[model samples]
Target: MSTSTSTSTVSEEYVSTASRPSDLRITDVRVANLHGVPFRSSIIRIDTNQGLVGYGEVRDQASASYALVLKSRIVGENPCNLDKVFRKIKQFGHHGRQGGGVSGIEMALMDLAGKAYGVPAYALVGGKFRDTVRCYADTPSLLDPHEMGERLLERKRRGFTMLKMDVGISLLWDVPGALIAPAGSRDDVSTMHPFTGIQVTPKGVEHLASYVDTVRSIVGYDVALAADHFGHIAIDSCIRIGRALEPFTLAWIEDLIPWQYTDQWRQLTEAVAVPTCTGEDIYLTENFKPLLDAGAIRVVHPDPATSGGIAETKRLGDYAQEKGIAMALHLAASPIATMACVHLAAATENFLALEHHAADVPFWSDLVTGLPRPLIQDGYITVPDTPGLGFGEINEELFRQQLDPRDPVFFAETTHWDGEFSHDRLWS
Candidate 1:
């Protein structure tokens, strides 16, 4: 059953949390940087005059500048005016990491609106399908079968029921006759998938299959397992590898082919018994339509940080639900972004699981307050009824301690990005 509720029919005044007509306005847009071991990611804070604030994070490795640049256009607008506010800044967001800013801004706005209205973010979108969102452990791929098995088994021990691993030709470099270098390009994955000539030989396929077999032997058949980052090989190799691993019943072969090549995706889906998944690099629903329409892949992976935030992600899920396609979220961000995924996952009926890429970072759960201490338990995030995103605030001392030595901890007044430099008019 779908817990999704259409609150649009409910008047804003009726949902107000402050007991008044809900006249809160955006006051400040602040940015902060947090580290994931060596990698640095950005988070945003959208404050309102009513003392309610919303927090969000940009896509991993993207700049806080992406979110800060939009402050001028967003400040002073009513955070509750989502449709209008999103459209106003939607023009500023483009594909890939550039979309992070607009998406982050939208997330912050949802939190603000949810807080002012005293509701969870999911309630603002639709209701929810589950109180808890399932998480898949995104454990790093280890080349050594013994080590990989141990690593995956540790994830199982840690309580992640579902798991994904990095597997591909990159890990097979030492094996004999595994990959053929392209005609002109270096061994780097610079060449496109099909043209890369990075053929995965039969020996290569068996080696990779054996590795997954080792993982399956340790974790057993009950838990769902997925494979990702298999190098930039083409469709033929993808099918060969997928077919070889068919007996393992791998959950899905992710990004086996690049996301844009729909025909290839369709071919991979048709060729293999295992499922296929993609769409993290994709920006909005428009880009995903062709993939869905073609029935290209069995699963649609939309990273909330990259896929236009909470509402747009639900739109993706709703679209997938109609087409009978499952949706899995790609998350490699902070708990703030992960919680956004949790709220959206609760609301989306088609949701499968949300990726918990930061499980290895001990301080990962410590980054945010007010949410649960563990953030994830037994591979699931229990939804909180607390108003807004339910994350109280960023742990300033811990955040500063984890800051990228190259950047400052929080917003240092992005006045340079405060104003629009050029007119942005699409219509004549």
Candidate 2:
């Protein structure tokens, strides 16, 4: 296969691979919503007549409208003109959460371009730093310590050496008199629009500590253990919970408070010995800079779907390297975003691990075909050696099984409010 390189006028240093000098055209763009899973995601499929198809996804729920609007901007552009296409779409997309649409489309284009050239997506980003990407399992939230231990053992049996659990829920039998607040007390949390309920109580916290202790005891000290979704509690409550679980030595405490609270994150990192990680909801590298520059946390986590797809996520990871920070991708969606992350992790040197949320979903791995190797073995995913993402085939059967009932799979018309706006600025 012949390859060509193009440099952006804005930054001569920014160069990317182009497919055959003239064969680069986006033939088709389609979106699919994979529902009923932990999170919803809109997957974008871009096809080219050159017999190459690329896949990318914009995070679900938060900004589906933005991603849909981006389809118009990308429909006729040359897939190989990555720099030009990204620049053009970005100008129309603005920044912050609204950027997801443009970013998702950009990811699909790159995936298509890579397949056209017969190189993994990472190679286009400047080549691979690692052949195998480390994976962390998101364990289920169980009510019993014994049951939680059983779940950990199951994950361990499947070869996962790193695991994360939802530690904020207290409704299980493990905690007694743990929930103190009335259902309406956390109305503020309710209004946030994404997550609701207050399950982690004082007794619940103690039970959770015991649960972590049990998990750590069974898994031993060699494995990595992490926690997240600590409920909508005050900073002091976070501190207390952090202190209680200190003995287990968690890998990091994730999203203990809202991600917007930079000062609170810094304080939490300072107060706890465990490493701190956040930024799944944050949009791009620019949004991540403040936390990295402030030394707010030892690790930076970004979900490619929400943070702007592969290229942007790679930029964020590269920047984090400059600050001596590690990058761990937070992903929970369809195979489109999961495979996109694999490419990014392969290219990034400072990358630590990537979350495989669908590890337990029987058909999740089947959603895409032609992966160069098994998605996971002994808790590690071998990067695809084939061109593009090496995604084999979309398992329509599996997709059907996972579709969200509330909103069936269909391409809705792009709402008018979706894309870049003159008044929009990323950070206020």
Which stretches of candidate 1 lie above 4 Å from their native place? Answer: 1-21, 183-187
Give one digit per residue, the lDDT tens place, for model 1 in 1-428. 13334455455536645523157888888887767632567888887787777888888888777888788888889988888898888887767788899889888888888887778999989888899999999988877877887888888888899999998887788888776756554456566788777788888988898888887898889889999998878788889998998999888889987888999899889999999999898888988999999999999998888889999989999999899999999988888888888899999998999998877788888887987778889888999888778788878888888777787656556667667455666788
> Could you tell me which residue pairs clash in candidate 2?
67-101, 119-387, 369-391, 369-392, 369-393, 370-392
Using lDDT, give the best candidate's number: 1
- Per-model CA lDDT versus the true structure: 0.84, 0.75
lDDT of 2 by residue, 1-428 (tens): 12333334434455454445366676566666777455777767676666567777776554566666565566667887887888766754444456667778878877777776777789899999998999999976776667877788788788888888887743333345776554565445444312444445677677768778877787778788888877676666677788888888889988887777778888888888888888888876888898988898888988787787889889999999999999999887776777788889999999989998876676566677776334678888788887777677776777766666765665434434234345433458
Score every model by TM-score: 0.93, 0.83
lDDT of 1: 0.84
TM-score between model 2 and native: 0.83
Candidate 2, after superposition: displacement of residue 97 in Å? 6.6
| Clash count, one per candidate | 4, 6
